[model samples]
Target: MNRRESLKDPDDLEFFDRIQKLHLSLDQEFLNQFQRSLPLNEVLIDRWERASRLGFGDQTSIYDSSLVLGNVQVGKSCWIGPFTVLDGSGGLSIGDHCTISAGVHIYSHDNVIQTLSSGRFPIDRNPTTIGRNVYIAPNVVIAKGVNIGDCCVVGVGSFVNKSFDSNKILVGQPAKCIGEVIVTDSSIDFKYF
Candidate 1:
């Protein structure tokens, strides 16, 4: 089909015509600013992290224009990418040597189910635990109370809502374990998929 005809679908890339851009205009400067002080901002990010019983050395890497974190633990040499918001509000714990890419939002915190009937969710929390040597890709949303094991690959834009076993690959919407990484000694050409 032609481009105009293709735009008829709701899932069309031309659907930008229907949606208003929220991030079309945003302060790009705050993207680089680190949250390591309280005297400057109204509330301190480090103090909040400390109060939650975390051991993250450089909290600057963790971005939060507005992030609600709970009791979380972070290990050494963990690279939490910029724009990544780890909310332990549900009581999540992250391990060491993990590479959480940009736009990866991990929220252990949630809204109270009791308030759902009243059209208000005050607060809900569930603990999230991620093991070491994990590679969580960009724009991946680790949902409330997800416990990902070590050495697993969370594909880009995947939503992880359940516990993932170690040494596996997960991808797609509401991601699932597709396969495991295999180390082969075959000498093959690079063009083959």
Candidate 2:
């Protein structure tokens, strides 16, 4: 009757059915646990598989919708969320156990000078580094050459343009250290200023 019902290959229909079922299961699980749904591309592409294909470290998972450019190095057990951008054209390194939230953008180069001077100047390139055990909240942007030290927390929607030492909790637009992170064997504390 319908075109799908009259498909030439039964295997194609079966494959589509399997994908739908997997998507539903994943969606339901996410809804129950995180009160969210999986993105359509995420349903089709396995995050860990994609990360493995990109040569990320063991146990690291990057969402299918995330864009990763050249020379990006991600360490073990990191979670790179959907719609994030990792611009590694100038070299970007993210250390172990980091959580890069959705909509976060880490840049290693910028064309500000070149664009402002109408191509008279070259694009500035620099390395960006994120140390171990860091958490960058949603919609945050880290500019080129900024090094975020270990055990740090970057608040949501902050624009980080400078380097910070370890155990800092950074917030605000030109992100500043508003707190310190104290890590113990079994607990972690944030001491805000």
Candidate 3:
């Protein structure tokens, strides 16, 4: 059902909406609990955080909001776009001063391979991690067993397979180094990463 019908529906949508609203309100409660978390009740915040985050704070964001991280630590002053999926199942970490564009998918496992091996089909996913000062464009797919170094840029619509060192601009399928990334007051250069 659409938003309008769902909002007006009485059977289940109403209940769903109520539950969602309550869940959202829990964030405020979480903040309050965090503030009130004493040495004696430090675990309270941790428990609340665990209960609230469904697989690492599934909050799609851009300018940083209430984040949920599971073995994944994101640094300060970064722009993570909406619908950006950062899975730390195998341990994902995002560094400071980065821009994760919209529709970016970073996987930790190779589902297609595991499907061909064992019985685990669609759910068998892997881990992925990204480093600091990175600029990942829209539609970038970072596959498993890959680590992107700091001060790098992944071009739009690129697919990464292997890991790379610092100071590079990656693009294309099975991404290759296009150039370096240089940022200045005048222009952002990709030839000097």
Candidate 4:
């Protein structure tokens, strides 16, 4: 079947168009408010404890064991694997069609200086942005203020502390460009060194 034939319904076309343009984010102010606010009186009963608690965008799925905190926002078709910790206390944004593998820890706030300095230095707080069609391998640690561009990949066990341009493949303890990413309408492919 041709691409045009697949879209028999106008609503399907509209939904597809929306997904292509999606960008996800949880802003700082919202995160602060959500963190400070008291919990609602209502308690969940008989419902499965899951990422559905958070207001994720269309077609986003998170593993049952994954933990999402504060004001995290995820775009369409995102897959968050098990044992992942997505800390959005500072801010966090994940774009469309991205894959975050199991045991990945993404932090928007760190208390390194504050704890080391006996509360003298403040905790570092910044927004972390992951762009569309990105793939983050398992056990990766992404620090605050990192901006990963579209169609990028972070290798397993890498600690990402800096930003990279679109279509780049990153690896190492402190991730560095290892290759490139190729994105098409139908798929995203990587070329590694």
Clashes of each: 6, 0, 7, 0
Q: Estimate each model's TM-score.
A: 0.60, 0.85, 0.60, 0.70
Could you tell me how far off, in angstroms, the CA of residue 12 lies in candidate 3 after the best superposition?
13
Determine which window of 10 residues in candidate 3 has minimal summed lDDT.
Answer: 36-45
Q: How does model 1 fare in lDDT?
A: 0.67
| Candidate whose TM-score is highest | 2
Clashing pairs in 4: none
- Stretches off by above 4 angstroms in model 4 are 1-49, 184-189
Model 4 TM-score (2 dp):
0.70
Tens digits of per-residue lDDT, candidate 3, 96-171, equal 7778887887776555755786765564544566888898999898887688888898999999999998889898
CA lDDT, every prediction?
0.67, 0.94, 0.67, 0.80
- In the range 1-193, model 2's lDDT, one tens digit per residue, is 9745776788988887787788799888878976978776776688899999998999999999999998999999999998999999999999999999999999999999999999999999999999999999999999999999999999999999999999999999999999999999999988999
Say which candidate scores most in lDDT.
2
Regions of model 3 farther than 4 Å from truth: 1-70, 120-127, 183-188
Q: Candidate 3 clashing pairs?
A: 108-126, 108-127, 109-126, 109-127, 180-190, 180-193, 181-193
The true-versus-predicted C-alpha distance at residue 10 of model 1, in Å, is 54
Model 3 TM-score (2 dp): 0.60
Evaluate model 2: give its TM-score. Answer: 0.85
Expressed as tens digits, the lDDT of each residue in 1-193 for candidate 1 is 8554656566665465433232222223223464323222323244335423445755323433435366666776676655678787677777777888878889886665757757555666778888877889999998887888877888999998888877678887898888775434673211211
Whole-model alpha-carbon lDDT for candidate 4: 0.80
